[model samples]
Target: MIKQVLKNVGITLALFILMINASAQKVTLLQQGRAVSIRGLSVVNDKVAWVSGNKGYVAVTKDAGKTWIWQQVRGFEQSDFRDIEAFSDKEALIMSSGTPALILKTTDGGANWQVKYRNRDTSVFLDAMDFHGKYGCAMSDPSNNHFVLFETTDKGNTWKAREMAKSPLARNDEAAFAASGTCLNIFDNGLIKSNSILMVTGGSVANMIQAHIDEKKWSTQQLPIAQGRSSAGAFSVATNGKNWVVVGGDYQRDTRTDSTACYSNDAGKTWKIAKVTPTFLSCVQHIDSKIYLATGTAGTYLSKDEGLTWTKIDGGSYNVCIKTQHGKLTLLAGGNGKIAMFSMK
Candidate 1:
């Protein structure tokens, strides 16, 4: 009986070890190497996440970020991957700047990334990409005069170019970093100012506003931004499957000064500029209810009352926030060649 009990205990211990290993996968930082700049990050789960940047590098972690393994792509080792996104543990994509847009897709995680599409006919830079199941879209800088929307239905196997209205700012061929989509937003009421040219297209502001994605499909209500004066634009957008938050820039035309952040309870329909202590903001991530994180020139800010207020955590730190399993927050912060972590709790 003693021997049997010992054997049962051993089996139970073994199972527990396996579960822990599965939960905490590895997270490799490509920025670990000298002269590497970590530009973008995306996490599918706690055990699985990806990061990309200059040096044509990409890294993956399956052990909850305890360790990481570096992966390389052909003809991209020297090119910069500005943005990355993961649909699941097994699928991911990376976007880079080039005359003919460069996009990389992987099926077996980051083990092998295949070039799915490239647009050499245009000089526009692909900034961001989004894929929901087999449907996805890519956004590019509008200076190239080429359309910004590229859709793929067969799991990014093939892409179809979409159209957008021509404007003077678009130069008859325009695209913005689809990275944030029109998702780019920032605060205008704060002290941090934006020097970028401010442009507002969507809203109930008469026929002046238009929805390029859909004509009658108003999923979000346009918020009132006081009248006459325009607020800064956003650099990133995050949704908790409920509230939608936008953060980034003042849409300044030339200055790096960005001071604007907004949130909407009903998708994108209406927005209320956050009344937080004024500070420059960048990327926004929603870890959970009442818990939010935004990072940029002012570093990372934690807000418990939505974006109504913000408190700076670290100075001179740029972080891309992600949600992990078990309601944990992952802050991908550190300069090129260095990576650090800060728990949400």
Candidate 2:
């Protein structure tokens, strides 16, 4: 009798272990709130998620997307949050449209956020922020004569300016960011784009620029530079480890395309025009080799071939912030303070 009991107990244990593994690897989304315009959203893992936007709005989700608790991130109430970068569930950073270049940090998940660094003197509307683990940097529009870039080694504890290595593009108030120093771009003849990683850059040089992380090794290429292309001035760029996509429009020309997108598979050496039409593209997120893009007022587009072809997933996407978790897609948009969520089929 004792031997038989032991055998049964072992069988049950094995079955339990298999069930846990299956549950942990699955991906899906759950409805947490109503549809509102969001500026930025990021998922650290299957459980932890974060979103930010104008008016100092920050939302956190601990149980994947099953539930979310809206919270106020300190520093700016009427400030517009444009970019957010996260190293882990416990640490993250945000860049906003404010004077003194607004940057916020939180060490304790999304429970609370404090102003870790701010530079009022160079305030020219901070646009984007990126990081290489804990060491990250940010770029701002050229407010003064000199363009500026901010760097922080110890997370967001402190920050300092790094002298730019000389750029030809007029500092006509541009914006830039990088996933890391290894995935950085210089907007000139420098390094070649890699197949393993996708890097994004934008501005007046949008669709007509080159980039490289390390200056020692050079990989230079050119982009599609034609006259009357509405999306000339790039606002932001993003990639999902497959294709690099840039978002910007001819703000100067009232008759501009809402969104301008271009991609290069061979690392920044050459770029090809994407098939989809973007109306004010904002950000992009990739999952399971599929690419999901977010655009302001133009809705959202999904592509499985790395921008080879795109299909509209949502109509009139007022989303400022969009992110993908597992197979779920989340967006924050609508100027009326509405946060919306969607699932990728």
Candidate 3:
């Protein structure tokens, strides 16, 4: 009888420790209270990362998130850098939105920036930028009944227009969210031998995954998320070839809990709504095949069971969360120039 009682106590203790660890996990602010609003973040490794934002603000942190070196591109103070991609501590790219959509690159840390792409038309609004090695692309809202995409093969030194014939026609009123710079992602889709550029759209079309499968074909699958208005619907998506997770909600109604998240395990043959969803989680990234971290203006959430359920680990507002592509580091960034460190251990 004593042996059984001791074994039961051990089990209870183990579970208690796990619960404590889970609850004790919270984001630690490393930077904040600045004037700019941060949305774009790129964590290249455990020790190197970068973030870009409004008013031409860009920052680099070499000691993880402990400190940052900030700079505003000398002559571009009015630009809103919506997305950033960092390849290393010294090399990075930032893409601005709004009229005069621009792409800039820096090689000597943040000291100097060279414009690589620009469009001044009123309709040109670049949303997000993603890369798979030297091959990369930037996406913009639909124009003239078609989506606009730009491709880069020589890093950020040059960019080319994707043939309009290859870019699939966009639905009426469909658009992508730039709130977190995550609505468009490019990586190996696993189904095809070549990589696929995947983009998620909102607005009247609700949430749909638009996959540029190859040079000549495009495919799509819809995600069940909040919609019906300009401010509602999916804002971000991430996939590990098989299981896919999407998170978003009405950013204008950020407190609503219904239909804010969903997941698909069979590459979008079907999707299941998250039982416990985050409120207005506009961005999501896979920590592993099962774990994911998401955030937005509402707060931050962590999911351990493939996004079916989540725990609101942080109540502080953030626009985006990202884990190191090849390391264990994770970080979150948001408005007021807030940057915080997070851990999944």
Tens-place lDDT digits, model 2, residues 1-345: 999999999999998975664343322224434433355566666566676666777667777655677766654677667666665667777777666567888888767778877677745556555554455656555545434556676876788775555322333433342211111222221243331112333454443333333332223243442223323444445554435655544434423343455666764456776766555455554444655454455555555567656555555434444454353545444445544554543
**What is candidate 3's lDDT per residue for 1-345, written digit by digit as tens?**
999999999999999997987866678888889999999999999999999999999999899888898988899999999999999999999999998989999898878899999898888789899998898989999988788989999888999888898886778888888988888888876575565777888888665555644566777776788877888888998887778888998999998899999999887678899999879997999987688889888889989888899888889999999998889889999999999998764
| TM per candidate | 0.69, 0.69, 0.94
- The C-alpha stretches of model 2 lying farther than 4 A from their native spots are 1-37, 143-147, 166-232, 240-242, 250-259, 290-292, 320-334
TM match of model 2 to true structure: 0.69
What C-alpha lDDT does candidate 2 achieve relative to the native structure? Answer: 0.52
**In candidate 2, what residue range of length 10 has the lowest lDDT sum?**
177-186
Candidate 3's C-alpha runs over 4 A off are: 1-18
The better candidate by TM-score, 2 or 3, is 3
- Candidate 2 residue 95 C-alpha distance from true site, Å: 2.1
The lDDT of each candidate is 0.55, 0.52, 0.87
Name the candidate, 1 or 2, with the larger lDDT value.
Answer: 1
Q: What ordering of candidates by TM-score runs from best to worst?
A: 3, 2, 1
Identify the runs in model 1 with alpha carbons over 4 angstroms from their true place: 1-33, 143-147, 165-232, 250-258, 324-329
Each prediction's RMSD to truth: 13.2, 11.8, 2.5
- Tell me, by TM-score, which candidate is best: 3
lDDT of candidate 1 at residue 72, scale 0 to 100: 62
